[model samples]
Target: MFTQRSRCLLLIFLLYFVNKISSKVEFTNIKCNTFDPDFASFEYCFLKSVNRTYKYLSIKVNLHKTPITKVKVNIAIFKRYNGYKPFLYNITKDACKFLLLKNPDPVSNYIYNGFKSFTNMNHTCPFEVSPQKLPIGYINQQVTDVLPVPHGDYLFHSNWMAYDIKRATVNVYFTIS
Candidate 1:
């Protein structure tokens, strides 16, 4: 404990650990499309940057038809290596049932936890239009804590379907560093 070399080594190790824990996830871009505008349409979807280190996601969807009885969502994540390739997760869930669960599947719960606080689609189905926008304020540390990946580029793709018909698709591009 008195040796200068040992102290230096310990300091270096602490710094590395701190940096690893403080790593952040940043939104690079977002793309959204509505296949059938009569059912639903995107009002706006984009990433906002306040500074080099601060960025947030903002998206809004207008539901033209109210009280959609049944809805399903398909989510897939990809990591970039030369080009985007499938990474860890690919799941499809019944939106209504998933939302009402007491404890959902681990993977779905992990992913949904990231945006649950920021979106309005919280309760079970019979979903209706919301006048306000869905602003996913920021990607917080809670999300990073559950992520089991190194620094890299990732894509989160989601397809929304209602009554067994494809309705919309959203692609979110982000980087963890």
Candidate 2:
């Protein structure tokens, strides 16, 4: 049903449209079947909850093997574990990624707010009362790290607080390996 000219134009349009989207890769099917956990919020532009820990938050990125060059992630604590407030403690910098590891003492920009300190996510030292300051909720490519984790339905909380707020957000950005 197409005239020669019309057919040519349609073909060109289709080719252009295909070409426009061919180079992008979206890993958006964020089901637990795709990730370790079956329950994750797909509200982020790109988000996945793969932990570096075998049992919990152990995630690995192949910065050396793929186009992903580098990654910078921050871990933030929340007012409550699963209820995101969207504003108050939304951390805009790197914090908890250091505490989640085995020996995250090298990262000077973090605090180990005790995991039990859910009411106050601000414990800079003593590393005991501050569970958020532990590396259990962190991921880093720095010198030697350990992926500490717990089992089943654990949400990684933020351990960093540069302001007077209580909510937090741990962010990771990478340039595909």
In TM-score terms, which candidate is top?
Answer: 1
**Candidate 1 lDDT tens digits, 1-177:** 469999999999996886677456777788999999999988888777766756677778988887798999999999999999998999999989998899999899988877777677778888742223223334547545555466799999999999999999999998877
lDDT of 2 by residue, 35-131 (tens): 2122122222224435543211112211122221122334442222365333223334333444345565532333333222332324332221112
TM-score of candidate 2 against the unseen true structure: 0.22
Q: How many residue-pair clashes does candidate 1 contain?
A: 0
Looking at candidate 1, what is the lDDT of residue 54? 62
Report residue 124 deviation for candidate 2 (angstroms).
23
Candidate 1, residue 3: Cα displacement in angstroms equals: 30
RMSD of each: 5.6, 20.6
Count of backbone clashes, every candidate in sequence: 0, 37
Off by over 4 Å in 1: 1-22, 128-140
lDDT for position 155 in model 2: 30
- lDDT score, candidate 1: 0.79
